[model samples]
Target chain A: MRIVVLAGGIGGARFLRGLKSAVPDADITVIGNTGDDIHLFGLKVCPDLDTVMYTLGGGINEDQGWGRTDESFTVKEELAAYGVGPTWFGLGDRDFATHIVRTQMLGAGYPLSAVTEALCDRWQPGVRLLPMSDDRVETHIAITEAGTGERRVIHFQEYWVRLRASVDAEAVVPVGAEQAKPAPGVLEAIAAADVIVFPPSNPVVSVGTILAVPGIREAIAAADAPVVGLSPIVGGAPVRGMADKVLAAVGVESTAAAVALHYGTELLDGWLVDTSDADAVAVVEAAGITCRAVPLMMTDPEATAEMARAALDLAEASR
Target chain B: MRIVVLAGGIGGARFLRGLKSAVPDADITVIGNTGDDIHLFGLKVCPDLDTVMYTLGGGINEDQGWGRTDESFTVKEELAAYGVGPTWFGLGDRDFATHIVRTQMLGAGYPLSAVTEALCDRWQPGVRLLPMSDDRVETHIAITEAGTGERRVIHFQEYWVRLRASVDAEAVVPVGAEQAKPAPGVLEAIAAADVIVFPPSNPVVSVGTILAVPGIREAIAAADAPVVGLSPIVGGAPVRGMADKVLAAVGVESTAAAVALHYGTELLDGWLVDTSDADAVAVVEAAGITCRAVPLMMTDPEATAEMARAALDLAEASR
Candidate 1:
């Protein structure tokens, strides 16, 4: 089966690792979100893409679920000594080189999509990793300050990292989404996919940003493929990340049913909710999308592969 | 006495350590050559300036004559894994961070002089280190291929790090020199100096590149200061580096007298040669410049300081 999985960072990377194990023969094409990309110390760091790449390439620090294993901080310390900006992001020395190479190639006139392919050439994640678009689409969060009524837009990292999502988010906007065209192979992959699975990633920022690009949602809806989404919310709380805070910014409740309804039956043919969210299945199925209750915890690769199997099973049933 | 020193990398850095010890109170400003600077992996690397900084800051690796004492290479290995470009240069993980910070600051519209000041804030080299210019001025060397008569210009790093300067140099050109301006404080430092000393640095590439800046040479000559140069060549050979090879490219002999005549008394008031070239003193003096024969070996800091003092004494005598 040709499966195209839309993903974010940690959870997505882990889930993809499982998917690879679950369906080794399945041609997987991952449409990774670049909304969290930041230019730190003159290197373009794509947090989501690297997370997926490293995790699948077996180089990720399994404990942190971000950055590479056995990474050093010599470069980071030198940068701090020079008083360089944005020292809070924790970019490890080994991690920095990846960004450097990516930024260099991008500066030399290669689109991000092409750069991703070149970077993936060595990783050989067994899945074709494609950035949602070649054009820049930064996710900005509109937040109300502690003392002010005015809502201001901040870069996703500033919102997620610097602020730690402390402020009240009014809205989340993906800047440049209006003009961003899907990457060269993105639309084709979505249209030709036999199964389109949305990993348990942040809906408001990860998969949402991918769907925000022009014509991507339309292509998926029009595809003959069975579209399935796994719930990132278990028992009304996110597996990781500040998904609830972002979901609140978009007026969506932190529940499996709410996320399914947010994506709607227009694009999704099947939905997989955690066993803890078994009660949400009826509400989601009432909206004309097939629903299943499965053990969705990705505590290990085996568990994650089982989750991946559940997603495929849901797609198969709906088909 | 105020002094301006033209410098290159390791040797220049080591010599400056002694110069500082010799004249503890003399106001010294180092005009570092930016010709050796290269943008590797999207980070601006000022190798010469860094050598000076690390050496004076007491963070230099005494054995390697470059990089930090406790440096690591996690970043470099990671970069190689990613198949990034230009892996030949000894860029340690800690060193990469310095370049990243510098490149980011440069991209943010800060002049290199100001950035150098900020970087020096931490190093506290005591001597003010200024780049030749804020603009890009790369040194390109023309080399004849062994198999073919075709000659091509390559960046200084490629010539030095990759080829180890093994090829016959046809010509050495500092690209962008015509349009490049002397970095801020460069002219002022020269003008305000009691004496200007050229440390036993590479005369052709290091010191030559500093003088190549539009107004620097003229400023030193117009200033009410004595300009003295210590020969990089001793016993008819360069103390370090292939200075003779590059000297040949510029049509100048590697002899101390030939180097003195190349600079001329038009810009220099005094010149210092080693005891081995004591006989050449009259030849250099005939050019209207005071010449001194000193034990110009900087085998240790005390000896280097003695050499620095000799240059100052010659400058005062000429005045």
Candidate 2:
């Protein structure tokens, strides 16, 4: 089967690792979310793309599920010593090389898609990885300071990494999404896939941001294949990351049913929720999308592969 | 007395360290050669400026006389793993931070001089550190590849570090020097100085490259202060670095008197040669520049301090 997966950062990367393990023969196309891409120390850092690349390429810190294994912080320490920062973002020496190569290629006039392909040449992530768009699309969060009641917009990374998402995100906005065209092969991948799966990633920032790219949503909605989504919110909370904060910003309840409803029947055909959120299946089914409950905690590759298998089964059943 | 020194890399940096010890209270302004600066892995690497900063700031690797002490090469190793290279350039993780900060500032539209000032704010090298030009000025060496005999120009760093100056440099060209204006504060420092010294840095690439800047040599020549130069050649050989290779490229002999003659009497008022090259003193003086012989080996800070003192003494006697 030719499968397509929309990935975010840690959670999505972990799920993709499992999906690869489950169906080794399947040709996979990963449309990585680039909204979380940031310029730190003047180098382009695509956190989500790197996470997916490293996880699948066997270079990821398995325990952290993001960044490189055996990473060193000498570069970060030296940068801080020079008083240059957004020091809150943890970029290690090994991870810095990825950004350096990306930035160098980007500076030399290669589109993000070409750069992604070039970077993947080294990682050989076993999938054709494409950024959601070649053009820049940054996710900026609108937040009001608690101490001063001052309102300001900050980059998604600053919101998540620096502030730890403590302040309530008033609005989650993908700044350049409306105008962004799908990267070169994105629409083709969606049209050609036997099944498209939204891995257990942040709905508002990850998959949602990818859909926000103008032609991508229309392509998936119009695709012949059934589209399936695994709920990032296992029960009433996110499996990892502070997805609840951004979810609330978009007026969605932090529940499997609400997340499925947010994606809607027009775009989604099947939804998978954790066994704890079994009550959400009927609610989602009533809304016209086929829903299934499964053991969704991606505790290990075996557990994640099972979740991948369940999502694929749901997609097959919907067909 | 206020002193202005035109410096290259290791030799100049070592001399500055000695000068600081020689005259602890004298205000010093160092015009660092920028022609040797190269962009590696998308980061600006200023070899001369960094050498002076690290050496004086007490952060230099004493053995290498350049780069940071207690450095790690994780970033370099990782870059090589990604197959992004000019792997010959040895930039340590700690040293990478300086380039990152510099490149970031340059990208943000700050001039190279301003970026140098910003970098020096952390180093507190005591002396004012100024790049010879805010504009890009690279020293490209014309070399005939030994095996291929392909005549092409390569960056000075590649010539120095990668080839180790084994190939004969046909010509030494400061690529952008003709149009490059003196960086801010360079002429001002020269004009206000009580005396000027050329530390035994490479005449052809170091002090020569600095003089290649449009207004710098003219400023020093017109200034009231006497300009004294210490010959890098001790007896018949360069004390450090392959000054002989570039000197040959510039059509100058690798001798103490020949180097003094290369600078010429029009710009240089006094010259200091090593006691071992005492026989060349009268030959240099015949060229219309006052000449003196002194023990010039920078074996220790004390020895280098005496050389700095000897150069200052020459400047005084000539005045």
Candidate 3:
């Protein structure tokens, strides 16, 4: 099977782990969200891409679902000692290698796509991981400080990591997305995909940011492949992350049916929500997107694999 | 008293430590060699300046005579794991922070001299540390590669660290030295100094690289101060490093008299050699340079301080 999946960080990585387990032989193309990429200490850090790479390549910290397993914080600690930091973003010693290599390659004139390929060579992630764009497209959140009451826009990392998404997001903007061309092979992967999946990633910032790329959303809409999406929301709250806060920023309700409607029948043919959200299946189907309710809690690889299998089944049903 | 010393890496750092102890209350200005600075992994690694700072700041590894006292190689190991390396140079995790800070400051448009001063504000090396130039002027060694017989120029770090100076250095070239202007305070320090000293650093690459700056050499020659130098050679061999190898590159022998003669009477007023090189005193004196044989081996801080005192005494005698 040739499958293309749009992925964010942790939740998406966990779903990818399950997808790989479900179809070990599938030729997977992961269009990793690059909006979370930030330059820390002058090193380019791609959190989402690294998460997917580490998760699939068996190097991810299973407890955290992000960064490398057995990682040390010597580099970060030393950087802090030198008073150089965005100290809130924990970049471990092992994880830093990825950014160093990526940044070095980027500085040497290799585009982010080629650098991603080079990094994946070491991880052997088994899936082709392409960043949404070679061009810079940072996701920034418009927020007001709870105590200071100062309202301003901050980079997505500062909003997510430093602020911990404590305040409501007024707007989530992908700064350079309108000018960004899909990284090499992204549009091709969408067109060649037998089935396209949006794993359990934040709709407003993760998969939403990927779609923000100028050519990507249009390419997937025109492709012959059936587009399937899994709800990051379980019941009424996010399975992981502050997806609801960002969902509200874009005027979408944090519900399975609303998420399906947010993607819309024009693009999405299938939607998968948790079994607890079964009643919303009819609501989504009423809007023309084929909906299925499955056990969406990724408690383990097997349970997550079952979720992936259900999403593929929905894709077939839509066809 | 205002004193200026030109320095290299380990040898110069060790000498500066002694100089600080010898003249505890004297205002000292060090014109550190930047020729050995190299960009490794896209980070500017200033080995010489760092050596002086760390050695004097109580953070240097006493046994290794370089890098932090309690250092970790996690960053370097991780970089190597990514196959991104010139792995021979041992840059510890703590050492990496200095480079990261420096590279960031340079990227942000701060000149290298300003960056060095800011770094020293933290190290408090007890003496003013100024890079010889704000501009890039890497010391390149021309040599024939072993086995391959490739005659080419390689960075001084590659020559010293990777090649181990096992191959003969045909020529030592400070690539951009000719056009480079001395850093803001370097010429002024030389002009205003009561005395000037050349520590027992490599003449061809370390102190020699500093003198390669056009107006700097002219400035020191015309300075009112008596210019004295301590020979890096003892019993016709380098006290440390492959000073002999690079000295051979410039057709100078690794003897106290030869080194003093190479500096010439036109600029050098006094020369200090090790007690074991007492025989060279007559030869150096014959060349119209005042010569003294002192215990130049910096066995400890006290011994090094004594050597510094002797160098000052020679400066006094020359005056």
Cα lDDT tens digits for candidate 2, A20-68: 9999999999999999999999999999999999999999998888999
Better of 1 and 3 by TM-score: 3
RMSD of each: 1.8, 1.0, 1.0
Least accurate 10 contiguous residues by lDDT in model 2 chain B = B259-268
Q: How do the residues A200-288 of candidate 1 rate in per-residue lDDT, one tens digit apiece?
A: 99998999999999899999989999999999999999998889999998899999999999999888999999998999999999999
Worst 10 residues of 3 chain A by lDDT: A77-86
The candidate scoring highest on DockQ is 2
**Residues B1-319, model 3: lDDT tens digits:** 9999999999999988888899899999999999999999888999999999999989899999989988888889878877888889999888888888898899889999999998988889999999999999999999997899989999999999998999999999999999899999999999999999999999989999999998888999999999999999999999999999999999999999999999998789999999999999999999999999999999999999999999999999998
- What DockQ does predicted model 1 obtain? 0.82
Residue A22 accuracy (lDDT) in model 2? 91
Interface Cα root-mean-square deviation for all models: 1.3, 0.7, 1.2
Kindly list the per-residue Cα lDDT of model 3 for residues A192-228, writing each as its tens digit: 9999999999998999999999989999999899999
The alpha-carbon lDDT assigned to residue A190 of candidate 3 equals 97
Distance (Å) between predicted and true CA of B263, model 3? Answer: 0.8
Candidate 2 TM-score to native = 0.99
Q: What does candidate 3 score on TM?
A: 0.99
Off by over 4 Å in 1: A147-151
Candidates 2 and 3, the one with greater lDDT: 2
Encode model 2's per-residue lDDT on B121-216: one tens digit a residue: 999999999999999999999999999979999999999999999999999999999989999899999999999999899998999999999889
- Lowest summed lDDT over 10 consecutive residues: which window, candidate 1 chain B? B93-102
